[model samples]
Structures are given as structure tokens and as C-alpha cells.
Target: MNIAPRYLGRGSWLARRDPRVLIVGLALFVFSVIQVWDLRILVGLALVAAVYYRSARIPFHSVRLQWAYIVFFVSFIVLANTILTGGDLRDVKSQALHVYFRMPLLNTPLSAESTSYAMAQYLRFLSMAAVGFPIAFAVAPGDIGPAFARLGVPDKFAYALDLTFRFIPSLAADMRATIDAQRIRGYEWEKKGRGPIGKLTRTVPLLVPVTVNAIVGAEDTIDAMDLRAFGTGRRSWLRELAMDRTDRLVLAGFGLLLLAVTAASLTGLTRLWVPPFLLPA
Candidate 1:
């Protein structure tokens, strides 16, 4: 099970850009999205995110599982918001809301404002995911630490970030190998024994070996690092990242976007915009 997001070998425009540029650009985009609740503005940002994602040329198949996870997470958040505070009309200027329907058991009224808020939340999260998933696919693994280092992160911390990125995939590969090994021994992982306890009991066989192996791997890595005198002195990265004219331009663009978003948000131009049709006359 290759569950880890592998870098697509395809040379898309985003993939060609410096890793630092992508990192800063994504940060700025996410911050901008966070500053606004206006559905219209969110829609525009979502379109921008869509274009940014499409530029990577990542195939649907490559990130299908990721998309599934994102959809599940966003749906859960939206549903929860609808149920918990669906009746709150605080944001409605007239303090009057048009109730669409009441939730079955909770009797919570799902009002127009709540519905609009849910849509805005949906677009907000989806837009973030759109820009985020591409980084795992587009940036080369080796460049992550160097990019962080070039962006003023301490040497050890930068390498730790790089290791963290690589570790998740390593752990996934280990889990896959452990599952296959257990399967050869006639372990039926899918067998739900009785209830929640049974489900957890079944996971023991898979988790124990993976956990032990992970601990041992960590120990080995620590020993190797110690032998090499890592963190004892200044570190020199094998790959030195340099920003070109295009990278600088891209970074400047994202900076400008952040400034514009901040200005809009501070000026109260990015408030929640309930559709005129949904307003009570």
C-alpha cells in the first residue's frame, strides 16, 4: 500500500518553482482565506485555489484518497456547525432568519444564515486543501529541509522538518510490510471479533510489530546521527536552493495578495454576505 503522497515525476510549472516560493505562497494563501467570511470572496479565492491546484497537473487518481479524506473532514465540520449553531442569527443584520427545516432529534432550526455560513466554511476548507495537497506531490522530498533552512530556520530544525516529512511515508511503508507479513501467517485483519473492543484487539497484531519496529528504527537513526556528530556544529546541505527571477516574482505576488487581503479584512469589506434573495423582506 503506497499510501504516502509520492512526488509526481511530471514536470509541471509548480514543480519547477523553488520550494521556498511554494511554501511562502501557500502560507499567504491560507492566511488570506482565514481572514474572510464573505461567500463571494471565498468563491473567488476557491477559484484561485482551483487554478493553483490545476497548475500542478496532479492526476485525480494520484490524490483520490486524499480527496476522500478532505471531503469527509470538511463534511463533518459543516454538519457539526449546522447542528450546533444552526439557529443563531447573530450575523444576520436584521436579527431575523428564514428557517429552512428543523433537525430531527435536536429540533435545531437550520436557517438561511447558517446554510450560507456552512457553504462559506465548505469553500474555505476545500480551498485550503486544494493548495495544500499539491505541495506533497509537487515538491521534491530532499528540498524541504533546504527550503526551510534558506527561509531562516535553524539548521537542526530544518533537517528535523525534512525528516518528519520522510518519516510519515516510512511509517506507512512499514505498516504495509507488517500487514503483508501478518497476512502470510493467516491473520484476518478485517475480522471484527465482537464489538469496539474486538476491533481494537484485532488491531493489536498490526500495531505492536509496527510500533516496535518504529522504535528500533528511531534508535538506529539516533545512533547513526551520533556517529556522524550531527548537531555538534554548523551543517552543510548537499542541495543548495537559490531563488531565481521567477521565484522572486512569485513570492512578491503572494506578499501583495496577503497585503490586499489584510486591507480588505481590516476595512470590514470581507464580512459575511447573505444572499439578498435569502433575506426576509
Candidate 2:
């Protein structure tokens, strides 16, 4: 099925940047986004995220499945938030709210303030996903470890991160193979169950073989590392990464952005903004 997230091999602006720039910039962007609940600021951030994501030139077809998953997850969270606590009432500046309608059965009042809060939450998550997805779908697999190593991450941790990225696709491939084998043996995953227990039981067929393969893979990796005397002494990366002028400029820009966002948040300039319509006159 080729469902794993792999580099799209596109020669786009973001792809041209150093991997470290993307990693550090993404962290700064995430931190900045999480500091505010204002819809205006969040809208601006979401636009920036959209631009950043577009710069990677990732085709929609390549990541449609991932997009579907993200949309479903985010929608579920927003719906649950609306149903449960009525959407973070703390962010509403005024105690009084204009009730729009009451949710059936739950009788939860769907007020304008709560609706706006849910919109803010939705934008918050979408913005994060926007800038974050490029890292997985754009960066070259070979560069991950060296980039992290160059960033002063410990050698073992750097290598582990590299392995982690590559492992996901490998694991997915293994799972797909296992599923295919099961299907050949007359197993139907969809027809196996109906409820939560059915779902759990259905996974058993896929999980067991995949899990055993993963354990074997891990042992093989360990043996290979031992043969190469890994972690015994100072480790050297096969690939060398150096920051260019563009990379330096990007890092400085990211640093300044983080500082500016922190100042704005601490100075209370980025407080949640409730729509005037939501307040009773």
C-alpha cells in the first residue's frame, strides 16, 4: 500500500534548506503557536504555517491519507471539547455569553464564546500540523542523524532519532506484508469484529507477527552495532553537515521570532480575544 511517510524528492525551497533549520524552526514555531488563544494571531500563524507547508511543494496526493487522519483526529478533539467542557470558558473575557443553541440530549449550551474557542483550538492544531508535516515528508533520510549530531545532540541520541524515523516506514512495510499473508490465509480484518473488543482482537492478527519481526529487527540492529563497535567510544557520523549563510539567517530569524513571541505572551499582548458578538450588550 506504500502508506509510509517518505521524502517526496521535490526540489522546493524548504527542501533546499538545511535539515537543522527545519528542525529548530519547527520547534520555535510550535512554541510560538502554543502561547496564544487569540483567533487573529492564530489565523496569522496558520497562514504562515500554510506558506511554510507549501514551500515544501509536497503534493496533496502523496500525503492525503495523513491529511485524512489529521483531520479526523482534530475534528474528534474539537467535537469532544465542545461536548464536554463547552470549549475552555476561561478564554472568554466576559462571564456573560450569548447562547446560540443547546446540544440535544446533553443540553450543553453552544454559546458564541465557546464556538469561537473551538475555532481557535482547531486553528491551533492545524497550524502545528502545517509546519510539522514537512519534516517527515521532505527531509532526506540520510541527513537526519548528521543534522541532529551537528546540533549538539549526543551521538547515541542522534543516531537513535535517525533510526526512529526510518523505522516507522520499515515497521509499516512489515505490517502490510503480515496483513497480506493473513489475507492469503483467508483472514478478513474488516469482517473479524464489530465493537471495541472486536477491534482489539482484530489487531492481534496483525500485531503479533509485526511485533515478532520488530524484535528480530532490533536484535539484528544490535548485533550490527556491536560488530561496528558502536557506543564504545567517540562516534563519528558518515555524513557531515555544515550550516550555510541561509541556514544561519534562518536560525537567527527563528530565534528572534521565539523571543518576540515570548515577550508578546508575557506582556499580555497575545491574550485570547473573544468576539464582541459573543458578549451581551
Candidate 3:
């Protein structure tokens, strides 16, 4: 529900850098992490992400809502994958959290291997998410259009992409405002906890207002754009961007990092790694 615009007042180093470089670097980092399973590589990626997050100077609480869902997702992955892994069942079990449940429809032996693998997968995703913080916290939605255009994307597509990013925060803010207004009017979901159906019904009051507001906002935006002769001619950004020496240096570093990650992956260094304590004997 923390829907305040993320990039309005941020003045961090990453926030001041060229959006094109940031976009490309983050894209590369995310791509590399998706194919990797090695703990060392995952940890390293996480460290790099942490450096950026710290440098961005954005409050951690602002992004905590997203990470909260990520934690739930990772937990579900660990529990589900741990039980569903196939092969010769060794009657193995995880030594870390020694909790075992037996159900009629579910009967698969758990092991430290599955647990470790799941943790690795979770870390891989977490690190990728961390690397994405700058996009959400520092990069203004308006900059995306110019950055993509500079990267050779078509003007129309770049404009659409920029609008998509800008709308996300706007929608979130609208939803939060609707919820707050409903709460003030004495609407309570917790008091009517009659299961999923009740929850759905309760949300109606919040959803209807948000949807109407979104439609109204979209129409206004379209009318304004049309009035301004948008998309009728060559679309140029208000401020032209040129890559400075710092931008060049940062881009070069990202290129080197990409090459190193690719080399490591090809050399079999990106294989799954289970911590010794978590590895089944």
C-alpha cells in the first residue's frame, strides 16, 4: 500500500546515472541470474545488488511490500518442491527443519538436497529482484521512453512502454486511496471472514472505485496527448541525453561482468551447490 511515487525526490548516484545504461545493465544481470544455480555466483550477484540498493539510498521499508510476497513465494517453492521431487526415494529428510507430515495423497520422501536446491532457486530470484530495485525506486517512468528510443526501439513502442510504467504507480495509489476511503466509511473485511467468497465480496467496494478512477484517468491522458499533437510527428525527448565518461565506464564494467558470468556458466561453474551442512550424507 506504499504507493508514493518512487523516483520523485531520490538523488542517489544510481538515480543520476543514464537510464539507458541502468536498463541494459539490469537486464543483463537478471538474464544471467535466471540460468545460474551456483550458490557462490548467486551470493556474488546479491552482493552487487546490495551495493546498488545501498547507493540508491531508498528506504528499505518502501520496497518491503514486494519482498514480503517474494518471501511467501520462495517458502511455497521450498515446501512444494521438497515433497514433489522424483527418483528412488531414499527415505531421506531435511536435517535443518525436521518437520515431517504424512498425508494420503502426498507421500514423497524429503531430503536436504531438495531443500538446498529450493534455497538456491529462491536466492537466485531474490538477488534478481534486488537488482531491480533501481528500476522501481530511481528510474523515472518518463525516462523509459527516451531510454528505449535511444536503444533503437520504435518511438511508438517506447512511448507505450513509458506509459505502462507510469500507470503502475498511479493505479496503486488509486487502489490505496479507495481502500482508505472504504475503511473510513466503516467497511470491514476482517469482521466478515466467511472464507474466499466473503473476501471477494468485501473487495468489491475497493475495486469498483479504483477501476472507475483508472478509466477516467486514462481518458484524460489520451485527450491531453491528442490535444498536444502527440504521435503526429517525430517524437523527441525534452532533454537530450549524451553518455558521459562515467556512463561509458559503468557500461564497460557491466560488459565485463556479463562476459565473466557467461564464461563461468560455459565452464560448468554455474552448477547447483548445496551447503555442506544441508547436503544429505
**lDDT (Cα, tens digit) per residue for candidate 2, span 1-281:** 77566788358888888899899999998899889788888898899889889999999988888889988999998888889874347745334667777888888788877877788889989999989898887888888999998889999999998898879887988888899999999878888448888878887989998998898779989999999999999888887777789888977976887788789899987776777867656
Better structure of 2 and 3 per TM-score: 2
RMSD of each: 2.2, 2.3, 4.6
Q: On residues 195-217, what C-alpha lDDT tens digit does candidate 3 reach at each position? A: 99888888889888889878876
Where is model 3 more than 4 Å wrong at Cα? 86-107, 165-173, 180-191, 277-281
Backbone clash total for model 3 is 0
For candidate 2, list the clashing residue pairs, or say none: none
Ranked candidates (TM-score, high to low): 1, 2, 3
TM-score of 3: 0.79
Per-residue C-alpha lDDT of model 1 across residues 1-281, encoded as one tens digit per residue: 57676888359988898898889899999999999889999998999899889988899987788899899999999888777774664447434667777889998887778878888899999999988877889999889999999899999999999899889888998898888999999988788558888888988999999999898879988999999999999999999788889889878877887898899999998877788787556
- Report the number of the highest-lDDT candidate: 1
> How many residue pairs clash (N, CA or C atoms closer than 3 angstroms) in each of the candidate models, in the order given?
0, 0, 0
Candidate with maximal TM-score = 1
